[model samples]
Target: MMNFTNQISTATDPAKIVDELAQGKAEDYNIGFLFVSGLSNTAMAEVIALLRKRLKVDHLLGCTCAGIIGSEAEIERLPASTLILGKLPGVKILPFSLNQTQFDDFQQVDDWLQFFNVFPNENPKFLILPDPFLFDMHEFLSGLNQVYPGCPVIGGLASGAMQPRENLLFINNESFEEGIVGVALVGNFSVSTIVSQGCRPIGQSYIVTRAENNIIYTLAGRPFIQVLEEVLQKATARDRLLAQEAIFLGIAMDEYTHNFKRGDFLIRTVIALDQSTGAGVITDYAKAGQTVQFHVRDAETATEDLNELLLSHRKKEQNKKPLGALVFSCNGRGENLFREKNHDISIIQKCVGPVPAAGFFCAGEIGPVGGSNFLHGFTNSIALFYPEEETAA
Candidate 1:
């Protein structure tokens, strides 16, 4: 069995926030997940030190963020919050910290497995928080894919720091300015992942006929610009306006599927277009012979996308409630994109039925898309935790 509780305090005083968090937490918890935001720069260390002494969990991991989400509120830039999950009776939680130098040491799958003392059959899930400025998560995640295959790794990149070594990452009681902090959970639970890029498919899907590196020159044997013109002509006035502000291209991650929808594609930003050359540049590499579609993003589309995904997942769960959830949303979302307070967390509460949830605004969110994990911006990555008995049913 698993027990979880989340606490959020608006107090600017670090000690006061800690006091509120420790008020009624059980003493038998094996692990604690903590997130802090809006506290003064001078108070980060003190707050962390106090939580370590007060919470007294066997293992603790978390990081500072631009904002913190706890309960049903998306508290941005003015609150300190912590979510604690009590002891899992049959679980093994191992907390680890790594820098760029240390990540380079584990060069092989056997090396990783041996280091973590985990076999491939253990099916562990990772909760990680890395500084976006220092670590190359793309390379790290790619390696993990080779080693762990389908293991779920969920968390967000630390936010609120302007430059290198400015962000705070925590493992146990220690804090670091440059590195990653996380834990490996190797027993008695499962985490279901939801990664919403928050965009809606706008135009019909097209097959790429010609492309050079990251540039797409032709789609369905026509110039890429021609395809864009045709799409814009058919789009609604509202969609056209959204396209002008933020248009993206979704490359089909699985070409085997005959029908493509919103979640079927790996969305990439349309960075630039050349009218004369009839070519386009995207943030992600596009290869010839891949299926692609245009997508438009706005507040309305984002809300619909999240609500649909959450509802679909709940339907598939057959009415079993999740124990808790960890949400990693891009800093660009929340009030900045939604223009409303408590947007993402509020939706989760309504759709996922008010399970205890905690998270932070990330510089880049991490979760799987198309059966592979990628670092994403402007995406909301959620991990829903459930016990063995819950999922077995």
Candidate 2:
């Protein structure tokens, strides 16, 4: 059996928060809590110590964040703390870390994966936390997809620090400045994960006629500049001027269907554009013949995307949904980007029914877009877990 419980604490004291959570926890299985959203690192450490003592579980980890999430209701942006704890009745928890350079070496990485490699158990889902401070998660996530294809990897870039360098990565009890950390949840449970990318298609898809590795030279066999100019003319009046800021490219991949849908775009950051030349530079590997489109985002699109994804899931309720959801959303999202307060969490609660959910705003979000999961931005990954015996899939 698999079970997860989440708790949020407003207490300035970390020890008090742990005591409160420990009281609600069940002791039947090995438990792990991803602690985030505390103001003080010293106090955060104090909370972990208290939890380890009160819970007496060998595994306890997580990091500090700007804020936290739990039960679908959380302090969207405030001094707060949230804990996501899971009881994997028959699963084993394996903790590990990775630096950017270490990411280049999979053997060193897999050596760490050894503890979490509970095979014959089959299809163990990994709960991942990459150090946004030191690792290029875009590359790191691609590597993970290559190595662990089809095995689900969930969670996000841990949040809280203002500077890139100050972001924290924790493993069990230790913290690292520039490394990825996570525990492998390996056992009889089959993992079901969903990536709710809150964006809608504003325009039609285009064809990439010319391109280099990461830059688009042309679309529809025309100059890339001309293609963008043509695409911009069709954007809504409010978004026409903010083209550079709001405009992004959705490149179609061989992995997904060619027919474009509202959420089918593999959204890439529009890193640069040549006003004179009409070229768009992105973060992905581009090539001739790849499908492309000019997409834009605003408050309404974001809100609608969340609602659409959640509503679709809710419509399919004959089967059980996630026992808990780990929401890995972009730091660019949340109140700073949304027009109102608690926007993302509120929609999730509305659709997902307050199942335990916890995560922090990440520097870059990671989820499947199109048919592949890549490191994402301004996106949310909601991974669902149901007990093996309880699930039909």
Write candidate 1's Cα lDDT for 1-393 as tens digits: 686777877777878878888888746788778888876556877877887788758887887789998878888867566665565768898788889988888877887887667776788787889999878798888887778877777889999687998888888767888888888888878788888999988879999998988899999999998899899999999989998897899988898888877579888898999999999898877888899999988888889999999898899898678888889999999999989999998899999867988889999998888867778889999988788734421
Using lDDT as the measure, which candidate wins?
1
Which candidate has the top score in TM-score?
1
What's model 1's lDDT at 302? Answer: 88
- Collision pairs in model 1: none
* lDDT (Cα, 0-100) at 63 in candidate 2: 73
TM-score, one value per model: 0.95, 0.89
The RMSD (Cα, Å) of candidate 2 is 2.9
The number of clashing residue pairs in each candidate reads: 0, 6
Against the true structure, candidate 1 reaches a TM-score of 0.95
- In model 2, residue pairs whose N, Cα or C atoms come closer than 3 Å (at least 3 residues apart or on different chains), thus clashing, are 65-159, 65-160, 66-160, 224-278, 225-277, 225-278
Candidate 1 ranges beyond 4 A from true positions: 389-393
